[model samples]
Each structure stands twice: as structure tokens, then as C-alpha cells.
Target: MPSEVVVEKQKLKNPPLDLRYLGDRALRQPAKRVAKVDQELRLLAKEMLQTMYTADGIGLAAPQVAVQKQVIVIDCEPDNPANPPLILVNPVIKQLSSQLCVMQEGCLSIPGVYLDVVRPQVAEISYKDENGRPRTLKANELLARCIQHEIDHLNGVLFVDRVENKIALNAELSKHGFSAKAVKPIA
Candidate 1:
């Protein structure tokens, strides 16, 4: 089982956050790195976790909530209350495996749009924990993919932008009433 937060789904309260959707200008803006991880940042992480749970998402980034800050909250095992969640501030991917895996990825911002995106099979990241302590995490499988996805948000990147299938990507975006031109594909 991947790392997760021990959150009671029933007791979770949805935070009042306006989630930026696909084609939203705010979603395209890069998130600024958080220099200080204080109580307020911790509180934001809690709220982000709550919002992610409410939206049935595994991971979320500050930019998704319209806050241009480099903060991310992720829980790979949301169904398990005993599992702990991860909160990363100013997360930087220090290493990525050469091996790649294609996984169907979805985003809270681009709801209802899922596409297969190729990403590194493993990732090692260094970041500040919720308590402002330096921490490092090495993850594989779904957890690894989720981390990469959220980190992309911090850099103003989206999963759709990583999709290689142009026809499928455009079709999916169009089906969801989103403009394909908004996607800034990574070469």
C-alpha cells in the first residue's frame, strides 16, 4: 500500500475553494514556491486534502484551488482510513527513472477527461513537510505518477499536456467543451 493520511472520510469537511477548471487562466499560471511552511500552509494542506476527498481525487495542488503556491496534498489510499496522506511544500523532483509507464491520468481541474500519459516509473522528490521539516520521498506505481502530476501543476503543466495521442487528446478535450489549443504540450 502507498503512503496515505489517516483521515476519516465521514468527518471530512469540504473547504471553501473555487477549483480552477480546464482552460482557466489561473490553472495555466505557474505556482510560486512557498518559502515558509507555517500554520497557515499546514491548514491549507488540510483543506486541500479535504477538498480532494470530496472530489474523489487522489492528489491536488495549490494552483488547482486558484492559489499560486507550491503545495501539494496526496492520498493514494483514500478508502483506507488508517493510511496516512502526504503534504509537500516546494516539492522538487530530484530524480526520475529512465523507465517509463503509460497510465490513464485524470485531474480535478480537468474533470471527466482522462487520457493515457507516459511518465517516469519512479520518482524521488525533496520537499518540506507540513511541519516545515525537510523530507524526501521515493515512490513508484500510482503514488509516483500522482506525485509527478501534482508537481506538474506547480509548474503550470497538466496531464493533458503530456498526452501523446494528439487525436485522442483533442477529441477528449473537445468532448468536455475545452479548447485543445489551451494545452501547451511538452516536447
Candidate 2:
């Protein structure tokens, strides 16, 4: 079946949406669950995909664009036109592997700040497709990490907030011109 919303996977000079940065209050606010799947929501997903591709990001949450809706778009293979992007609405993480892995993570919202963050190696999530159909996904490795990271945005969390190395985190944030105070650490 074709994707509910489709756009050429290419970077445009001006994307439809503007991204909120690390310290922006909009990015720090939790997103609201989507009440219904309709043309407007689908359009948002399409615009988000375009913005994500333009920003060269593998995943993006609605909150990152200050939309304040529980929506996410992911495409690990932005270089592959054959691979369809994943648009998730009101996504919920149902399971996470006990096994943890540390991987380098970066975000468009945080710009140049990249750091190693530990997360479950595998994850299972349930969410609605752009067409309002319910679906479940079991993913591992980078896909799992992407899912977790994007979902965290729906909850007003950023990848930097999960960085365990305080020294590295502080240094990177400072170098990137973002305040360490903006990061709300998780546990």
C-alpha cells in the first residue's frame, strides 16, 4: 500500500515548517494526542517530512516544530527514495529491551551538539498511521533508538537530556551555544 502522504525525498531551501531549537519553550512543552486523523493532520505530516529531510534529520516530532501534537516522522534512509518515511501519531512505547546500548545521537533542534546516549537496544511501539489506522512496530538498533528519541520529544525531552557524560554534555552544549540549564536531565 502507498503511504498516506507522499513527498519527494529531497531537501528544499525553505521547508514548510520552522524548527524550534533546544532551549525554545515550544520544544520543551509536551505534545497533545491527536484526536482525529484527517487531511489537516496528514498535511502536517507531509510538511514535517519535508522539513526533516531538509534539516537532514532521521526523525522529528511535532513539538520540534512547535506544533504541540503527538506526531512524528522518521526516515533513517533519507538517501533512499525507495524507502518510505514513517509517520506516527500519538505513538506509545509498549516495550523496551533490558539490553542497553550507547550510540551517538544528534538532533536538528540541538544543531551541532552530538553525544553518546544510552537507550534500550530494542523497542515495540503502537501508534496510528497517517490514515488513522492503528499499527504496532517492533524495531531494533538505530530504528529503535529513533523511535525512542522521537517519542521523547512528544513528552518534552531531548536526546541531550539523556546524555550521561555531564562533562562532555556541558562542553558540547557550550560549544554549540546552547545553555546547559536548558537540558532537563532524566533521572
> How does each model score on lDDT?
0.88, 0.95
Poorly placed runs, candidate 2 (over 4 Å): none
- Give the alpha carbon lDDT tens digit for every residue of 65-166 in model 2: 999999999999999999999999999999999999999999999999889999999999999999999999999999999999999999999998899999
Model 1 lDDT per residue over 1-187, tens place: 3223334554245455768898888888899989887868877887788788888899999999999999999889888877788889999999999999999999999889999999999999999888878889999999999999999999899999899999999999999998998899999
Q: Report how far residue 77 has shifted in candidate 1, in Å.
A: 0.5
Cα error, residue 14 of model 1, in Å, equals 5.3
Error of 1 at 57 (Å): 0.2
TM-score of 1: 0.93
